[model samples]
Target: MDIQYVDTYELTRAGQEVHGQAPIDQFERLIEDLPEQADTMVSWTVKGEMDSFGQRFLRVHVKAAPMLECQRCMKPFEWPVDSHNRLEVVNSEAALNVDDAADADPDDAIIERILGSQRLDVLALVEDEIILSLPYVPKHDVCTLLSEPLEEEPDGDLARPSPFAVLGQLKKD
Candidate 1:
């Protein structure tokens, strides 16, 4: 089914938990965002919470495997994607725009200001996370073509110049 939006405020307020699996095919933008796709689906679980400061928070865990085209050999490969996110829901974007926003602690949960009646486009969020998880240049760890191609020799043996021949001439001189 199509997952467009969710009432994040209510879910967070009631401390609700949401978990489900959906086919990635529903996400058109997500389908084309990466180089390729393997027949797969995205599974996710979102849990609500309230911090000591009475701030609404949501923890999201997503898992998926997207087919990726190897940049080194142009071969299709599956890239397992598992992402976890913790978000704090704020009343306004002003909180997110504060000067210290950029300096927020990495270990701290990311702050997400409420948007449009506290409704969240969950699918969009998943798509974004998937995109961020993609490798800049997808490639296999060990590519088969790393070594140079073997050159064809004349027959069983091929003779050329010898280093000793030049040394022999020098010795004669």
Candidate 2:
């Protein structure tokens, strides 16, 4: 869902009293499109403030139950994930772009944008947080049903290169 920037601005101006639920369909779309396996049920609460840095910031706490395929056994398993995120929405395109380019830190960029904006997109902020919270490699616990060992190769030397390794060899000039 496209969160109304106007509402965000109003909330900030009115002492940042915003609180509510955001649609999760957009987040679901992102998970579906991910190259790796992932599924989650997420909910969040957003609190806005003007930080010491003089930027309008939103502090978000998200709770989720993520389902992912085990890397070792390739079976699905569930894991709980709780994340806290801070975001900033900047007003001017110039300022936003400059902040985006100046530093690669997500938190810093977010704070810059929030403090600089009169309005913010709540949905966008939530989506960004969720994306950031996703694990790079999700694995089940050792005792989980999905955990298992793979069979050893018939050859005693399991580290040997495959026949296809010749594909990388350069032809003689």
Tell me the tens digit of each residue's lDDT in model 1 across 1-173: 34456677777878887766667676677677565565567777777777677878778787777777888888887777778887766666776555655676775634454442356877777777777788899886566557466567576444764434533432331
Best by lDDT: 1
Cα RMSDs, all models: 18.4, 15.5
| Per-residue accuracy of model 2 over 57-91 as CA lDDT, tens digit each | 56677654445666666676655545776656556
Model 1 clashing-pair count: 0
Report lDDT (Cα) of residue 108, candidate 2: 53
Give stretches of model 1 more than 4 Å off: 1-3, 33-36, 101-106, 109-117, 147-173
For model 2, the stretches where C-alpha displacement exceeds 4 angstroms are: 1-6, 22-26, 33-41, 52-54, 99-121, 143-173
* Residue pairs in collision within model 1: none
Q: How far is candidate 1 from the true structure (C-alpha RMSD, Å)?
A: 18.4
